[model samples]
Target chain A: MDNEVLNTEPQPTEEVRVVMPLVDILDGDDGVTIYFEVPGANSKTVDIEVKNRIMTISAASSLRRDGLPVVFKRNFRLSDGADIENITAKTQDGVLTLNIPKSERAKVHKIQVQ
Target chain B: MNMLARIRNAEELLPSTLGGLHELFRSMLDQVTDLGPEWLPEGSAAGRALTVETSEKEVTVKLPLPGCESKNIDVEVIGDQLTIHAARTEVKDENDKRHYIRRERSFMDYQESVLLPVKVRGHEAKASYVDGILTVTLPRENPGSPDSHVVKVD
Candidate 1:
């Protein structure tokens, strides 16, 4: 039973590499926002990367002082309407939010009648 | 036929677009080592997994509550049971009209209770939420007692 409990711990070990962070993707008139749940991550330890319409969020959890570190990773596919060059991201209280703005041509706008 | 040889042969037959043998092995490993629902902590019935650590004088409980603010959380202890309740509210900006492309996060209500493993002074328990993790520390009712007593769970 002791071994069973130890083996079932949620903390990740050194060999754990592939982790899927829970996420939420939201869209608005101007842009989109994505939220990732990484329980122990802070601004200093999280990394965001985007290339060829693929966005990946990678983070390391360091909350347990005496426990092994846990890592989190999640990927997203950007739509053609998204403006990749103007994307912005922020991390607060273990939640990472990404704001991906839509391209000027894709955003809805009214054209005045001539 | 050797199992390794057969696996390699099967890998060659699979499309290269699917990441070939490397992706296949990684997925197999993930399936074999996946921690199912059974791995959830002893006391939680419907919430996420919780971590419990015991020391000489106190027992500490840690739970993840991402995006949950302290204002919406409540912790209570009753007899040998400890319960956590929280309601999460999504924060939105006033300027923008929002639409959801794929929404996985929103308002969520959580309530979970756990039976204490050892005798504890429930009245003296203290809890705090920090960096999205709720930590509860409960002191032993009779520390240094000759035998540890397990409290009955209702």
Candidate 2:
């Protein structure tokens, strides 16, 4: 009843325009993986950038309606130990997965006892 | 230094300086809570934007459930109410012993019911899950039926 409208009518605008997609960050032996939910976004519409140790993610969705917009964006700061040069990203089923490897010096190494 | 977790706002969480993220986070929650009254369940796996579009013939509802498998999703319609239940189980690798340091995304057990503005053919309603977006289309019960008529007065 709140959003019901006829086909000929235009989509009602929402009070809030910008939205932040939900995210999940996990750590592993190799590195860390981050997941962002931006439905309706695909490889072609997603954009990822890292500058000055700040990583920014954004995507453009095909569907637009009240309380939701066509664009999605988020930003993150890389850790000192993260290997920015080796960061990789992929978008699947509206979720963006980014993997950031640890730098060589940052990896833990066990020293042999003499 | 530890790598920061993903922040919902466009602003990155700087280690030393606590940025003025209060307003941004407040706006984010406002956008989320305004989706619908019964659109989201408390402590749901993930929050999503729900869109309802109506046409002359049918009413369509779209909800995005990322990381969900098709088998775990269930769609049911009774009368003018439509219910969607979906779950996404976490994948735990046998050899991977590493635990989640900051597990933000995992199981998505979602259950929500919405009331349709117009009567629909519950039995004939069709639903499809494509690219993480579940679209349910219900045909109107009476497409061309007039709701009101003017009586002729002599």
Candidate 3:
């Protein structure tokens, strides 16, 4: 007689960081507005960084059913017109919004008619 | 006269411009197909994302819905399944026809259903939305039921 036992325990694996968040960029007259849909992430877990004309968004999800926690990430290359120093970001309800204002020279100005 | 000429010019430009867009769209589809099923959206909803978790005493469901008001969201538990429906209309400026350099946000309407792993008390389910995450918790009807078991062959 031959009998076999089954391994019921789950094997631990390394964290998978493959998924990227979807984003939308809106170019306005004076600045640019960007929106990102990053579900399962909150303000505390999300990270936004901008340096040398590059912007990176990374976040770790708080909710999980199995395996390693879900991680969302994306990168963007900014144009020279953006004033990176005055950029502002806000996150609410799994959506992140970033406002990048334009420099003085980039703003539109009306000229007087002769 | 120049305005009419510009309009005619735009009409002439349509096919080539749209052809470029069609090529771009096809390339995007190829990229998505290359990434495989893991990159595709989950559940029946086209773009909505959802998660389901099972525990000893309860089962939980979560979804992300940003800019959605509480009044627009609907939750229903029918038989061994859970359904969530939501709609959010984005308000936009009527006069400002700002040229969009990059646009991603829009009004969203979604309906998704998830099957429960085990029998649960659907009537006693509770749901809450916090920071854009909607969480629904339902208590299992029979807590003592074994989730896994081993049988011996005769």
Candidate 4:
């Protein structure tokens, strides 16, 4: 048997890279909070805007000296009726925190007999 | 002659005593040799960092942001996505006479993103910054179904 022919079996190709953004969400009585791990981002480079009941957050970080590539870009789509009027947010230590307050009508209220 | 040889060969067929003993010994030896301090302790500081929780009704995010100011931070929500961005630029004052042994903290710029569980009405979202921590509140969608019709009794 020819050595080359015997070793000519097909080899599998390497898998493709997939980047997924890291995010965490917390639920509270008043509203929900969201946390994101974004390193090397600043207030000026970040933009958060709400239009027609949709909230979008975008940020870009400066390149490092070593030219390390960014890991992933993530976007979240929330329900339509979410109250964005009273939304609050902050970023520090590479962590992004968001607090979303529930609307008054959404909150459960007890009814009293007249 | 052939029949006798065949019968004798069948009677002598028996299990070998040392079979598989070498492999078992090798495995045990490998395990004993690979034990060390790093291998012994795992997940020692697993839960020391900040924790985040989210649900369908609302999205709540918490982070441990120390030594940061609210003025240096910016929060925005577009569609269902919530973003928080903070930047701190510290310029060393050389004019003032000061003795410094070590300066550890450098200029830091941080940004993060969170995905809402439900569609957040951007107009109704609220945001607040306090101390070093930033919190964003996104309300849940209306519980009542959008597509509802009242039926009249015939």
Q: Root-mean-square deviation of each candidate, in angstroms? A: 11.6, 10.8, 12.6, 29.0
Task: List the TM values for chain B, per candidate.
Answer: 0.59, 0.62, 0.62, 0.48
DockQ of each: 0.20, 0.21, 0.18, 0.02
lDDT for each residue of candidate 2 in A28-101, tens digit (9 for 90 to 100): 66676777777777888888887666566767666564435555555555555678889889887767888888
Task: Report the lDDT tens digits of candidate 3 across residue range A19-79.
Answer: 4555655556767676766666778888878665556677766644344566666555444
For candidate 2, chain B by itself scores a TM value of 0.62
Residue-by-residue lDDT tens digits, candidate 3, B1-154: 1111222233356687586764444322211111112223331132235777788899888887766777889999998889999887653466655444434455478788888888889999999987667889999888768777799999
Instruction: Supply the DockQ value of model 3.
Output: 0.18
Off by over 4 Å in 3: A1-13, A16-18, B1-48, B91-96, B104-107, B147-154
* Model 4 lDDT per residue over A46-105, tens place: 566655433455544331212332222333323322467777888665445666665665
Residue runs of model 1 more than 4 Å from their true location after superposition? A1-14, A63-68, B1-47, B92-96, B144-154
Candidate 3, residue A2: how far the Cα is off, in Å: 62
Runs in model 2 deviating more than 4 A are: A1-16, B1-47, B91-95, B146-154
Between which residue pairs do clashes occur in model 1? none
- Name the best candidate (by DockQ): 2
**TM-score head-to-head 1 vs 4, winner:** 1
* Displacement of the residue A62 alpha carbon in candidate 1, Å: 3.2
TM-scores for every predicted model: 0.68, 0.71, 0.70, 0.33
Question: Weakest 10 consecutive residues, lDDT, candidate 4 chain B?
Answer: B31-40
